[model samples]
Target: MGVQDLLKNLLDWVANLGFWGPAAFIIIYNLATILFVPGSLLTLGAGVVFGVFWGSIYVSIGSVIGATFAFLIGRYFARDWVAKKLENHEQFKAIDQAVGQEGWKIVGLTRLSPIFPFNLLNYAFGLTNVSLKDYFLASWIGMLPGTILYVYVGSLIGSLAQLGMGERSRTSVEWLFYGMGLIVTVIVTIYITKIAQNALNQKIK
Candidate 1:
């Protein structure tokens, strides 16, 4: 089948699962992060289907769980092999040194911004000396704001779609509200990251 047909079939399957379908999808999507699927897509989809509040919660939880799992896999199963394979590469060594010195900070920064890919971090962090508790806590806290923002944006888009095209021009105020919301989200994320970094540094020292 064509890509559109495949997507439709998947959507149908998701619809059949009802509320549980989205939750399941979020979980599975997170679990498969190593496959290079952007977790934001799942969060956005959740928001589109379930509204902002529930969608944000679902994505946050799924991300935490998936990240934890990936960390564990990296710690126990993949670290040695990966290190051996990449040992000759200077860039890889630099990353390793950076993680060793400030793993939590690196993870936190990456999570807060869209700079590095989340899936890669999930696996790469495992190769570091960061404790499981530290990894999970940092991952959850760092990822929360972005997850919420994307989910809420998805919810807004869904509302707009439901209202149809003509309503968009008529609902200029609503669009303004969304723009304001986006601005607020960006500010909040930056503030939260700063606070988190300070707290992490204190703890590390």
Candidate 2:
């Protein structure tokens, strides 16, 4: 089956679970993330299924747990393999070493801007010297803003889909609120990304 079909089927199954649906989806989505699922897609699913507040909460919990699990897998199980690969990668080597020197700040910056693939970086950081506590803390905090923004967008999209675009936007308030939210999210994301870029540059140097 196509990927979208597979994803929809999975969501449908999860929804059939009733009161436990959100919990089930949280676990499934967390695993999906570590398996290299596009976070944006899963995030939108969260928003669609749970609305903004619950979606954000569930995503936050699931993301933190999944990231920690991925980090541990990298640190304890895959370090040797990952290390061998990094031996030939100067940029990655630089990041590993810089993470050693810069600690959680490096972790925070990467989580914010994500120079590396999200799934890979989770495992990659496992080989670094940063402590699990620091890594988890920084990751949770760094991932927060982006998570909320995506979930909120998902909620908005859900509203549009349910109400129909024509009906929803027939009034100016809905359009205005969504427009303002989009603008704010874009501005915040840009600002944070610029900071992360600077942080990465400094760490590289």
Candidate 3:
């Protein structure tokens, strides 16, 4: 079978598994994030299938769980190996030190900015000396806004289609909702990031 046919079959199989199917997929997807899957695809798919609010919640939870797993694995299993891999790099060493001193703030900033690949950040963080609690908390809070924004965009698309409006009108509404979601996401992200940054700076000082 062709690739599209295989994907169709896989989706059908997932559908046949009922609600448990998505839940199971989510667990596996989050785990796969550890292996460097670009998490945005999964998040977007979740939004498409589940609508915004619930999709965002599920994505958030799964991401946090996956990130925590990565962090723990790095801390206990692979820190030495990973460190050795980066030992010759001055910038990597600087980042490692920064993470040690201000890990939560840096995590929050990266989460807000979309400057780095999410999976890479997760694994790189895993190799850092940042505390598990700080890592989890920063990731959980930092990721929430973007998750909600993407999911809401998907939900808006679905909702517009369900409304049976004309194609042009639906497109317009989708853009409108997307713009609104973007504004909200940015505002909330900034506020939360500031809070986390302030707290981290105080703690570091």
The most accurate candidate by lDDT is: 2
TM-score of 2: 0.74
lDDT accuracy of residue 37 in candidate 3: 59
Query: Highest TM-score, which number?
Result: 2
Arrange candidates by TM-score, descending: 2, 1, 3
lDDT of 1 by residue, 5-106 (tens): 443344446556885787666656566565545565566566776788877887788788888887777778888865675567543344445556666765
Q: What TM-score would candidate 1 get against the native?
A: 0.67
- Model 1 has a clash total of 0
What is the clash count of model 2? 0
Worst lDDT window (10 residues) for model 2?
A: 160-169
lDDT of 3 by residue, 1-205 (tens): 8433433344345446776867765685577667665665456556656667768888888788887887776667887866675568554444555666566876775666554457656767888767788888998998887787666655555532222234534456556656755665466455545554665677799
Q: Give all TM-scores, in the order shown.
A: 0.67, 0.74, 0.67
Models sorted by lDDT, best on top: 2, 1, 3
Steric clashes per prediction: 0, 0, 0
